[model samples]
Target: MKNKTLLTVLSIIGMGLLLGWFILQMKPPHVNEKSTPSANQQAQTKTNSPEEKYIALTPEAQQKAGIRVKVAGPVQIKTVLELPGEIQFNENRVAHVVPRVEGVITAAYKHLGAPVEKGELIAVLESRELADLKSQYYTAIKRRELAQITFDREARLWREKVSAEQDYLAAKTALAEANIVVTAAAQRLLALGLTQDALDTIPQESQSKLSRYPIRAPFDGRVVRKHVVRGEAVKADAELFMIADLSTVWGTITVYTEDLNQVHLGQKVTVRSEELGLEATGTISYLGYLIDAQTRSTQAHVDIPNPEERWRPGLFVTVEVAEKKIPVPVAVAAEAIQTYRNQPVVFVQHGNGFEVRPITLGRRSGNGQWIEMVNGLSAGERYAADNSFVLKSELGEAMAPQ
Candidate 1:
């Protein structure tokens, strides 16, 4: 009986120890079903928030994205409103030549575009009328001399009481009439556009001198066009050589009527010519008060000196009339302005990736280094300013499917 009780007690202790271990394991709580999500849900999430859409770039990709080519475009360090215009001749330096006499063509000295001095003759007309004038002058002189002789004889007779008062009076009247006739003849010759030399050298049939008319240049200029040829009969006040002096040329530019205030008298200007090369200059000389009612443009004139006569008239030129320097925003090269579905866009850097934003642009620099941003941009935004084009392409492709 004693051996049986010992075996029973040992068995009870083993069962108690097994029960305690089983309670401890149950308290620690081993779950039979899965309480955590699988790996797939962690790897791929579906959400519409920007936070979800943004994917952090790898180290290699971030470095590559930062490495961008430097490109330059117009920047509004100072905003300028450039007005356009063309070249014109100074109005003060233009002149025209015309004939003043009504006669038949005797001879012409200068050709259609020949140069001449101020007192030079243009065309000569042989007037049967002019020859008659000279004859009248000589006849009048002879008559005056005879009249004076008669008056002297009559006066002597009157003093001696041998002549009537009417005879002496008639002799004096004749002398006065002859003097008036001679004066009228000289004025007639002078009206024929001739100098004293020309009048004295007038070709006479008796003298056998050929008739000639010399035309002179009114102002120094190239013959733009001619209207008449030699021996062609032209009427009085006929249009002749159209001459202009080109020492100082006019830059005729058109601007909006509203922009008149931006320009001022004698403002300094920089002139440029593709054909003539660079760094030329001029100044604003005149501004037209009247706006072109039809075109809504005001005409402004700039005078550029043509010392070597290089600036030719009618050459189409581009002008830039600069206004006051005002501060404004501008950005990257032209290439950076990419078109997404016909919308103007630029790539803006955000975190590790980039996003597309629309921008409004203004005038480009002459060298195309910068462009003005009229709108669609704010200050203090870091853009992919230089090589934004490459990323613009990437963003466009990335969003196309979405």
Candidate 2:
């Protein structure tokens, strides 16, 4: 009984030993301590080695891409007040030509868009009314001539004592009355736009020409409107032609009540037409005292020299009034800015290439040609100024999934 109990104990011990050996074989081998890393160490390694993105190009390639580089530095930023406006004729230089006398249009010498010099004949009129006025002037002159001859005879009779004093005085009074009538007739013709030279020639002019009257231009300008045609009967006050001296034009700006305080006469203004690609600079010359009731706005005009006449009247334009000027430490050309990953960025010059740098923007210039860099850029750093889109396109292609 003792031997059997001992055997059972031995068998139990042997089974325990076999199970321990099996566990040892299945376990992994131990590694060197120097080859293994801790959790913190692994995380730190990942953090330190981040993927950097950039574009690589040569100087020749950049030039071929039409990329222009400029140094970032202090820039004069303009605070602009923008307003809507339209090009209009300078009212001071415009004229509404009218005939002073009622007449029929014998000829229309000037047409729309025709240029004329001062005192140039623009039209002719034939009127019996003008003829009657000329006849009265000539009749008065003939009566004055007869009176002068009688006055000479009467003066001689008075001086020589050969005639009665009452007769001589009567003849002298008649002559004086006739001279007054002649003076009145001459004044009447002078008031009808007839020059002194014209009056002197009227008596020598043919009777048919006595009815002819010429309408002349008041100044050097272009005919903008023609209201009369050949054979058309026009009234005395009718506007026959509209002439405008287009050497200068007016850019009429509508100033809202909110912008009134910022606008004033003599302020520098720039007028721009995006569609026509036209631009001009001038100073504010006029401001309206009364505000428009419906628009709740006042008008201001800038007199711009339009020697080329490119600034046509009635063209809608944008007026930018320079309110103030500010100097910024860092600024870049507006065209240099680009959108990347929904963020505003600029291409900064790197060694042999450029790197995309995100930036914070501040105020823009009044001309919209420059932008202030609040951050992510430094003054004196070279950057892409013109055609920066080329760099952006290259970056996009390089980062795109293959």
The candidate maximizing TM-score is: 2
Q: List runs of model 2 lying over 4 Å from the truth.
A: 1-52, 58-69, 164-169
> Please, what are the lDDT tens digits per residue for candidate 2 over residues 1-402?
999999999999999999999998896878877598888888767544312246889999999988999999999898898899999999999999988788999999888999999999999998788899999989888888898898889889889999888888888898899989978888888887889899888779898999998989989989999999999998879999999999999999899999999998888788999989999998899999998999999999999999989999999999988888999999999999998888899988988988888899999998788899999999999999999999888888887789
Clashes by residue pair, model 1: 73-369, 73-370, 74-369, 74-370, 74-371, 85-253, 121-214, 121-215, 122-214, 122-215
Which stretch of 10 consecutive residues in model 1 shows the poorest summed lDDT? 47-56
Q: Candidate 2: lDDT of 388? A: 94
Clash number for model 2? 0
Residue range 214-259, candidate 1, lDDT tens digits: 4566656655446666567776577756666777788777778777
